[model samples]
Each structure stands twice: as structure tokens, then as C-alpha cells.
Target: MLLPWLVTCLAGCAVILSPVSEGCGPGRGYGKRRSPRKLAPLAYKQFSPNVAEKTLGASGRYEGKITRNSERFKELTPNYNTDIIFKDEENTGADRMMTQRCKDKLNSLAISVMNLWQGVRLRVTEGWDEDGHHSEESLHYEGRAVDITTSDRDRNKYAMLARLAVEAGFDWVYYESKAHVHCSVKSENSVATNSGGCFPGGAWVTLEDGGQKLIRDVCPGERILASSEIDGSGELIYSEVLTFLDRDPATWKQFFTIRTESGASVSLTAAHLLFVSKGNCSGGEEAAFGSMRTIYASDAQPGQCLLTTVTGELVGQNEEGRKGVGRLSRISQVNMREDVGVYAPLTRHGTLVVNGVVTSCYAVVDEHNLAHWAFAPLRLLHHWTGSAGGHVGDTGVHWYSKVLYWIGSLLLGSEHFHPWGLADPWR
Candidate 1:
């Protein structure tokens, strides 16, 4: 099953193809922006990503097994490419359930975490990548998780929306710098294969759908679930669901910790926004551009989650600012972002992707922390940016342009100067 040839190409086989400049991507700016396309949020008392997967019945990218009982869970679509409106499913995946309680949580989070200016509408992509993570990380088998992104490919949304998620009701959360959110209700341990992983007592639960079996375990009493991260180099290891025990229903209803990745697991939602960068090994300049692609997993699998990466064509870039002569491994994710941010733009552009605060490193965003001033949701408009450039005189996409773009939108996207429904074109 290992495509060695493809892997070799990805690992620097050749640079024959010319690098093409794709057009600019969607940006937030001042003006009559489009109506925020809000879809029905996933509700069902946030489960682990694995639970969300199993509930959705996923097998892989476009194939799955579904059931009527789990169809409602699958109805909530994550960020996928097609233009979908409402929570209804046509081109995307949906099979989870959200009672009135779940829906209300989402609506509240949307308003509470919204930046008023930067994040007008949000997209939820890969809410449930169904079996996307490695074995032992499948909450879908237990039915508890979801992923959400902005429909407009907004990176600023990742930081703030992640914060808002805690205000809703979720435990195990992982934000991708790659423009996607992977969440679950049950606190999970993703480092079963790592050295710190202690699961000798952990029992495996078998989840099989369409030729896929998810290997998982349940922790009884108190056990550690850890997630951590290594800085700068993108070595992320952040744990959620620490000190959780599964045998008793009473304790199950209570809060417990699940140890995440150690050393490198900084936060569960580190990769909240997806960013793309390409540099040739042959001593050349790196070509980094932010491109987004969306996929829905709930459709194929009605109550299962299965994630597998696909092979993509290459478009290599050499140091000479020219594209050609190398095999470019294609990579894509929804709502991804760059780890580093420069202050030339909003100075405080959104990247903290959470509506809540970090108690420990891997703890979920708690509602209690949402109101803190230091823990405030990110802002797109700072005095420096406002005085520097308006929308017309703003920087496009270079060296983390999302910050600058968000700043310019203080003029275009925010409603600070006007009241709702007054002169607000976006309202």
C-alpha cells in the first residue's frame, strides 16, 4: 500500500514541472461583504473526533458505510469544496446529531467568538475526518466529535472559533494550522505509540466499517491523556482528556484528563489554520502560498470515521523564483495557518484560535476563561494598522498577510463605527 514511487517524488525526486502562480485567495475587507453563510452546527454533546467519525460512519475520503440511526450525525458537513448552504447535506458529509442544546451552543459560540470585524462568517471543515488520526485516537468508535471551518477560507477564524468551541461544550479538541478543526466530546489520548503512553490497562474497542477497523481503548478510573508540542519546527504534541475514567457513568459525566503528546504537544488546536510552503532542496527560494481545499467525510461512512491521505501532483519551485524540474508532493488542508506572525499588519492579528484560555497546555477552552481580557478573542484592527494602510493601500499575501488583511478590514469588515442594521452592509 506504500506508494514508494510517489513518496520518493514527494521527498525530492525531480523538479520538471513548472510552478504556476494560482490567483489570489479570498480575503476579508471593508465593503458590503457577502452574507455570512452559516450552516447548522454539530451538536450531540461534543464527542471525541473518533466518536464523531464512528457516528458518521466513515471509511475514507469518498467511501463509507452509513446507517439511518447515525444519519443525523452525518448531516453536519465539515469544510468541503462545494458551495453548500444550511446544515443540509448534498455534496458534503453529515451524520451526527445535535439536539436543541447542541445547536444553541454553536449559535452562542459563533456570536461570542466572532471578531465582529475579522470573522464575519466561519467555515467548519473536516469536523469529522472519520478515522483520520492514527489508531487509538478514534473518538468516532465511541461517537463524540466534529470539525468546523469558515466557508470563506479564513485563517483568522481558526484561533477565535477554537476559543468559542470551549464555550460550547467539548473536551478533546485539536486545531490544525492547516485550516481545519478536529474535535471530540470524550477526552482522548493520541500518543499511544509514544514513549509516555501508558495503556497497558487500556483495552481496545474494535470499530469496523467498510474494511476498516479502528483500534481503541477505554480508560477506567483515572488515567492520563496528554498532548504537547515542540516549538518553531512544527513538532506539535498537545493532549486532552487527561485523568479520565470510563467504567462509571457518574464519573464519565464529570471532567477528566487524557494525556496528550508530550514535549511537542503544546495545545490541542495548534494547527488551527493550514498554511502552505514549498522550498526546493536544491538551494532555492521557498514558495509559500495559502491555498485551501475542502472535503466532507460523513457521507461515505454513515457512522464510522476513516481518514487516508491521497496522492497529489507536484509543482516545484526553485531558488531562482522559477517553477520547474521537480516533483511537488501535493498537500492540502482547511483553515491552516503559519506558526510565525509578523507585526507589520494588525500587530495582534488573530492566531490564538480559541474563545477560551489555556489552563494547562492541553486543557480545553473553559467558558470561565472566555471573559478574561488577556484571553480576549483576537482583534483585526490595531492603531498601528489603521494608521498604516486602509483596504486600498494594504498588503496582499506576503509574509503572513492575514494580519494586514484583517487590519484593513477594520475599515471594511468591522461594525465598530456603525450600529447593527444602520449602515452595515454586511449586517
Candidate 2:
């Protein structure tokens, strides 16, 4: 069962993410953490009369959980190592979204490579496992990286696996320990590079909405060059607007993933603004807004003018791109009540500068960067999240969308897009 496997694996090996909380319903991924541990937070009534913000990962270090998908593929080999899966050891590569054919070939290839050693069972270490906290570079995120392990004199086996994988249409293969191997493929370039290089195609992405999407890139001074968009068929949907601009996507702390005219799918993060904001200013990435019992006036002096704010209790679209009204009720300070406040107001017409919940940091706020400044101060109420034993998978709740794009999530492939976009003819 994926559920038990998810739980045990998460608690044991650092493989997959922890079990997500079941309240939000399937695909609604709030509680669905990649690991099994829970975040220590205060209940709504604990600290009202205060307001603040907290980071998603500020809770603690990565707990040992087997949440990655790599290990799942490993069990398919005719020669399965049940013990490896049972133990809380690192995995080789089982969780990625690899096709079955690729999987069969991989197990055989790994075994064949391991054949170089004598009397030693092959154990895997980190195939498709997520890149740990420090290094976000891995084929694992895309289901392409695999880590194979061994404990004997099999240098030849190590070389054989890496070498064979490249020959078998898989490229990036290398050895890193007395007991393991790492292998992956480049995003493009038909010719594989066993020579050991990074994935092909730099990070920026093109959409089909007469707009360009800057896929998640973290370079400090990188700019968001102008581009077009993708279309309903997931193809470049725009007329040639390839003229590049001096704007940087990083600077906006905001970028659009417009593929159609409906504007439904969008992704944003705080870092998307701070260091990446259009120009360059050492704005504090850490300055933030949080929910508490009551909203407190910004540390700014009294004369400072601020757009008034209303209680953010539901999801809706305002001037600031897409905003998420927190579900927590009593944003009280001290983790008591959902103490809510504007780290920076989630303004929509200007640059995004609010220190908000991690989602605000990542997905809230609009493209203009202007936060929807609150007319009223932040406040917490009991059951702020509004999901108490009543609504389960109900579509009755509605929200205005700021996404401004259409998405054929089921029928689209990512390759049809380009640097600018494809939103030209039919949406």
C-alpha cells in the first residue's frame, strides 16, 4: 500500500516525504509533507493579540524518512534485495518516474556492473533521492538520478554500470564512494555525456501565453529576459515576441507561467522577489509578515502611509497576483491563535516585499509585485483555516483566479514551449 509504504519508508529511510495531513483532501498538498515528521505549531487560541510569520522549513533538519521514489523501482528486479528495503539504509534509485522498461534495464545494468565484484551484495544509496538541504542538483527531482552501492573490490563493476548506462541511452554515470554509483541523463543533446557534466538547457523556461516563465533559477544577478508563452496544447502559443529585455525574472520575485488564457496555474516564491527582484537591491529576504491573534502596526513610524488591509480569511485574487487568505483562524502571537500580519503587504501593483507564510514566499502575491496592502490589521479567529470536520473535497468553495492562463493539465506536454511563449493564435 502506498500509504503504509509511505509512512514506514518515511520513518525509516530518508527516502520519501512524510505523510501529508489528510484533512486538505487528495492532491491538496498542505499536510502532505515529503517526510513523515510533523511541524510543531501552536493551536489557534494559544497566542492571539499578536501577529507574525514563520518559514516552512524553519522547524528543523531533515528527519530520516524513506520518502523518495527511487526505491520503489529497485524492488522490481528479479533479484530483489528485501533486506535493503527493510533496513533504514539509503536507497540507490527507486522513487523516480522511470518507465518499467527503463527500470528493468537499470537493474540488470546495475547487476551486470556489480558483477565485477566477488561475494558482495549490491546495495544502493541515493537513486532519485532528493538532493539534501545543501545541493539542489540531482536527477532525482525529475526521476532521472540513481545511486548504486557496493562494499567490495569491484572497481570494474562501478565503471561498467556507469559506462553501460551511457551506452544504453542513459548518460551521466559516475562513481563517488567505495560503495556506490551515481547516474543520470542530460535534459537535451541526443549525445550522452559520460564525461560527467550538468544537465543540458539552462534553467529559464518559455510558456505559451505571450509570456515567458523563468523556471526556478537562483543565480543572484540573473535577469528575466523577455519571451513569449505556451498554448493549450502545451506548445509555444505566441507570435514571435523573441525580443529580449533587460528585465530579470529573479528581480520580480515573481514570474508568470501563462500557458493559456484562463490564467489558472501559477507558482511564486518569496525568493522570487527579494534577491531576484527586477533590479538589484539588497532587500532583506528575511523580513516577513505572519498571522497571529491580531495584526500589529509595522515598525514604520506613524506617518508612514500603508494600503489598508482586510482580514485574509479566504482565497481570492486582488491587484497583487494570487493571494492565499490563511486558513488558520487565530493568528495570535506565541503560536497561540493564527497570529497574522503583513511581513510586507502582499501588494499587487508594485514589487512583492512582504515576509509572509512560506506559500506567500513561494506562491502568493501577483506578477506586478504589488502586494494587496491590507486595509485592516491582521487578526486571528478560532478555526481560521475553515476546515473543521465539515468540508471534505467539496467544490462549493470558490476563489477568483489571478493566474490568467488556461491549463490542459492532462493533455499537455512541456516540450512544445519556447523561450518567449506560444500564446498567439487560439489563446
Instruction: Provide the clash count, candidate 1.
Output: 136
- Can you give the TM-score per candidate against the true fold? 0.25, 0.23
Each prediction's Cα lDDT score? Answer: 0.26, 0.26
Per-residue lDDT of model 2, residues 1-427, tens digit only:
3354333322322211112123222465544333432222222122111211011111111112233444544422222443222112444334433433335446665554445445555454544444462144444543344566444535555554444444343333454454555554332211111111011112322222212333322121222211011100111111211111111221211121111111112222111221111222121121123211111111112221121112232133334223322121111121111111111111112122111211121112122111112100110110232211112222110111111111211112222121112111121
lDDT of 2: 0.26
After the best TM-score superposition of candidate 1, give how far the Cα of residue 352 lies from its true spot, in angstroms. 41
Query: Once superposed on the true structure, which residue ranges of model 1 sit more than 4 Å away at CA?
Result: 1-66, 69-102, 113-115, 127-137, 140-143, 186-427
Model 1 over residues 1-427: C-alpha lDDT tens digits? Answer: 2254223322221111111101111334323344653533333333223322322111111123223346544533333323222333433344233323334444554555455434355444333333444245444433344456665666655655564565354443456455556544421221110111011121221111111111123211111211111110111111222111111111111111112111111111220111112222221222222211111111111111111111111133234322121111222211211121111111121111110111121111111111111211112112212221122222222211222222323323222111100111111
For model 1, state the Cα shift of residue 335 in Å: 36
Off by over 4 Å in 2: 1-102, 114-121, 130-134, 151-157, 177-179, 186-427
